[model samples]
Target: MNASDSPRPSALDWLVEAARVRDAEGLHRTLAPRRADDGVLNLASNDYLGLSTDPRVIAGAIEAVQTWGAGATASRLVTGTTALHAALERELAEFLGTASALVFSSGYLANVGVITALMGRGDLIVSDGGAHASLIDGCRLSRARVVVVDRGDHEAVRTALRERTEDRAMVVTDSVYSIDGAVAPVAELYAAAREHGALIVVDEAHALGVRGRGGRGVVDELGLSGAVDLIVTAVLSKSFGSQGGLVAGPTTLRDHLVDRARSFIFDTGLAPAAVGAARAALGVLRAEPDLCDRVRENARRLATACGAETPSAAVVSLIIGEPAAALEVARRCLADGVAVGCFRPPSVPPGTSRIRLTVRADLGAKELDRVAAVVTRARTAVAATDAVRR
Candidate 1:
């Protein structure tokens, strides 16, 4: 057949087939943006301290916009280094008791940049099986010999580090596992890394606002902020109620990242408004240290309601087994005025679909009681339906 005689191959046919497959698997996703002034009790968000809407944070953002305009005009190495950015970095370093900090556009870039900058083809990277996607991507992009140990396996980490053929090695993990809310054995991991003379990177994205005194984070809680081989990374969007990511560690590390981290070197600096709001949130966290306690208390309460283990951070996850069932539970909760998070494959492993419930400091006890009731009813109903099907 001639080229023009045969049917034309549609360039987008694969996407349509992929969508059909996803739909059949009950994995099709759609955006559902919350309306302003919506009365839904949001248990799905990462704003643990509820500072996203705080007047001070809003004001800080506005002031920054008025002063520095809407966006950062350039990358950090160029003209984007504003005084606000410097102040935020200094304040973050002080708050976390780190020698210095380098801010990135987002936590994902921070992970990618840090890994690829410090590690290369000749180096070794020991990662946790449960590390965040950003960290996983960083490991892949670093072109290093990567070995993933089981989550929180210090001995395995040590073994990997010791067995490394490269002269340099790094161990990376999340301080708190995001999905299950399991806290990593960071202290033990750090000890193991030290014994093997390897550097350790702890992604404190989930723990920064809920763990340690005044929300200093797990590293600070464990008194490892001063450890020469330790690096702590956190996102500003969660407890900080802003947007951006930061790497806090020795000044030498910050200097190295600034020079070698391509993500930092190429990406525009975080917006002035985000930087300002993050600074304000830090102030709020320092002033109201009990916000941390309040969030964890709420998490524990939610955990009890869902029959999940108490979380070390602000996340309370209920494993619902199947994606459709988990989605049903989330929908029921939302219909009852409580919006919880639903996680399926790719976000979590297959067959481990779950409902992720996050707590906020500003949530009242009465509100929490209502949330607990709604979640319990939804879960029970889903379980009953599943049993009947079985």
Candidate 2:
């Protein structure tokens, strides 16, 4: 073979150059093993209601393992689904006040299913500019013409809907923006969707167990309930302290998804332990509705101490602006026996890198003070670093 015919290095070598660029920009990521017994206070997790380790939640999971074995052992369409799954779906739908609900192995899959099943060629999708990665990917999978509007901009959403030539359209968004922790304008979006005759699909992954009456969700808080034509999706891993995803919508939608949604049709059923845990969590949420207020209160405490206004939910974003500054702040907090989420692009927009603190309802007054102080110190350190650099 001629020298020119030989491959120029290899595609694998390109990864090394990419890594160097990421390292230079402070955009590289590494996974650190979490030591449960370590004395680090956690503000990085999505366990908003602090039920993940609750005695009842643990017991429910254990009992399910005994009853249904370990793994699902098959797909839901086969023999994977158990009575536990059915019960959880029914209870979740009823508790959320929806016509019906369907379960998925992960919230990500549920999102993909929603888009793939509902919108194909000749359909349209209006998405939020800052929607979660899952929703973004889901839209990409659809054959629909997708339009992204500014975050929570109902006018833009409506404009896109108005301009669509397709008769069937779906408006997709996250009820709560994960990075900034800002709640979406669900009511306004609903109105636009209704006016445009578009179906609404909202991923309540961050809202389901943290908003509304007993964490019923933003739709319930807005009293959309059965009155609005909508679809809601959530992850059980977060607020529910379990692992799985669900879709709550009309009975017909559930039926269609069951047959047409590739993710749901092929993926293994959600594990029995997750089903049981979510069921118990839902019951606990209903009985102890005050947990919702507690989480919000904790978030406000952290936000106020960070010099930011009170946040509506458990997440409080302390924007660092620069990627290096955000990483430095996160490292400082971790060194001080606290763990906080460090968000950088492409998770968030460039120049908006920040530490995202997710407050737990169980955090005591003293714990909250400690978290506040640590965050303040990290932020101050970032300021000092900038001053010295300048």
Q: Candidate 2: how large is its RMSD?
A: 1.6
Cα lDDT tens digits, model 1, 1-390, are 898899988998899989999988879999998898888999899999999999999999999999999999999999999999999999999989999999999999999999999999999999998899999999999999999998888899988988878999999999999997789999999999899889999999999879998998899899887688999999999998999999999999999999999999999999999998999999999999999999999889877876779787899888888889999999999999999999999899899899988899998889888988999999999999999999
Q: Rate the local accuracy (lDDT) of all candidates.
A: 0.92, 0.90
Give the alpha carbon lDDT tens digit for every residue of 266-366 in model 2: 99999888888988888788889989889998999888888986788789988898899999999999999899999999898899999999999989999
Clashes (N, CA, C under 3 Å) per candidate: 0, 0
- The residue ranges of model 1 lying beyond 4 angstroms of the native Cα positions read 5-7
Worst 10-residue lDDT window, candidate 1? 301-310
